[model samples]
Target chain A: MTLSPIQILVIIAAVALGTMITRFLPFFLFPDNKKRPTFVIYLGKVLPYAVIGLLVVYCLREISFSSPAGWLPEGIAILCIAILHFWRENVLLSIGVGTAVYMLLVQYVF
Target chain B: MQSDNLHSPKKPADKRIKTKALKAAFPHTIPVLTGFAFLGIAYGLLMNSKGYGVGWTLLMSLFVFAGSAQYVAITFLTSVFNPLHALLMTLIINARHLFYGIAMLDRFKNTGRLKPYLIFALCDETFSVLCAKEPPAGVEKRWFMFFVALLNHTYWVAGSVTGALLGSTLSFNTKGLDFVLTALFVVIFIDQWKQQKNHAPALIGLLCSTLALVVFGADYFVIPAMIALLAGLALYRKRAEKGETL
Candidate 1:
């Protein structure tokens, strides 16, 4: 709200453009008919592992020691996810159950 | 490669095939439906809290469509107008998609006209679904990917609009709902972990990102962690090629 409507639009436009560039540039670099460089192929193969790892940490990054709740809810919920997933090997079940546990802890217990 | 491709069905993406693909793809996207709904609603409420109306939330969700970046943009929208800074922040935050697009180059190669939108809509959840799951027999690959993207996109937009309209009028507490994303990512990580013989990549990712989060703090750890992970992977790969195991 601090910025005028036009300014907000401009920021949004820039963000959209920047995101497109990130998503599209790699494809342009490794177009069909040409062999993708070995390193890019290596990245393609392994990056998913690393990317998901980063995202998992990204979720827990907000919890601070100064707060009393700290990492308890996140830790417990992660345990719930691992258990549910191992027990049933179901994505929805694990996420639903883990989030429910975390929600209940935050909303009621913590 | 050409002979193998020529043997596969070269369906022209007729409506019937596309519809069939949609049917097959919807079930796979159901998990993403739950994840995106809560996350998108959080984003919409964040925008509303900043005094931006439902119109702006819808416009940004429709246009920007970058989940993490949109959340970050809430901060940007309230800050001073510096287009250059906003652009840089967006690029850094979304640089992860470079990996997704690279990984998808081959899958998306012959998708033809649908390629651009597929790339545009190549979000993290969509990437996981398309990259990790294959369509049923006889469903066109392109159409399957299309529906996954379209369905996820629609769910996101719908969730944001609902949240915007509901603006501060919630009858119930919605705190901790964003954990859906965390759980989803953890689930995907476990799937990848179970499937791979090499756990180095996953371990390195977990270690480096956590290290970055601790060292750099949450507000600015992503890009550094990414850079560190890339360097770490390169070193790890070289060691692996040198007859080193584990």
Candidate 2:
């Protein structure tokens, strides 16, 4: 798809406006005296987990366990990385290993 | 207050304050910068391949600045120029910012003029940094916030400009370039997971979101899953409180 100059501008403007609306609303609209409700605080604390979960699910949505090059290898890789990450607390190693395993699976095993 | 006094004896130690703030900001930001560099380059290459050049790349990064949304915007602009569709697509892609904003309200309240821009730059990575902790005393919160935004922006612009100029010169397969984002999220999840002793929330999030995705599909699951996760966590909080052996 190729956008003309005008379409590009409109898209940029819309995205910029939408981004700003979400980001700037609380800062501008909420008064300094305002106190967040209890639920808001709870939501803040739990939101990160929810976001991460969403990402994981999103990544795996296209893959299926039924296929040969499917969920078995990728799922194992994800579990391995998650375990290493949880146990050893090493981000680089987990991701590096996970990616390597994934590539291997996609290349030869799966 | 005594602890604050001991840390900042003369003139509030703003000099040391700035350095300490930078130190705190740097570690959390390394992965973000790395990921943005690759993603920005991918975006630039995609844009250039689509016939847009450096001017558009720079302008979009400066004004639009939503990484994934900007990527999707490229496709939308290329296909058709429907204003309503563009608006709706943008809203859907970026709806998570609403939650991010709510998360930041308390921390950003004292940030003064920087607050607006801080909010403007509150991408996923930025929120991870800001919501992690309070800035140390003597460090002007605005300056730290400024550096985080500035650094990420610079990396993105640099990557985009490079991609625009040398889009064809780089011959390596770019199929996996988008994985930078996935890598980044994994890094963040690991970091967040390691910090807390209680892994229940993370586990719950993983299970609930995965289940929701199976039911709702990837594009539509995020907002509803988030709401469900929040509800579940709130309900579990009482049990967590009781289980604490204080």
Highest-DockQ candidate: 1
True contacts kept of 2: 0.53
In angstroms, the error of model 1 at B64 is 1.6
lDDT of 1 by residue, B69-156 (tens): 8888888899889988989999988988888898888889888778899999998899888877899898889889999999999988
The clash count of every prediction, one per candidate, is 0, 0
What lDDT tens digits, residue by residue, belong to model 2 across residues B1-246? 335432454655656765676776676567667667667888888887878888889988887777878877877767757877877777777777777777667667666556667777888777776666556666667667766776677778888877777776665445435545665677677777767676777787787777777788767876677767777777778777788721
Assess each model's interface with DockQ, reporting 2 decimals per model: 0.70, 0.49
- Chain A TM-score of each model, in the order shown? 0.80, 0.65
lDDT of 2 at A35: 78
Q: Which candidate achieves the best lDDT against the true structure?
A: 1
Model 2: CAPRI class: acceptable
Q: lDDT value for candidate 1?
A: 0.86
Model 2 Cα shift for residue B10 (angstroms): 21
Q: Per-residue alpha-carbon lDDT of model 2 for A1-110, expressed as tens digits?
A: 46667777877788788778767775565556877677777766767655665565555656665676657766767777777777886656766666666666666676
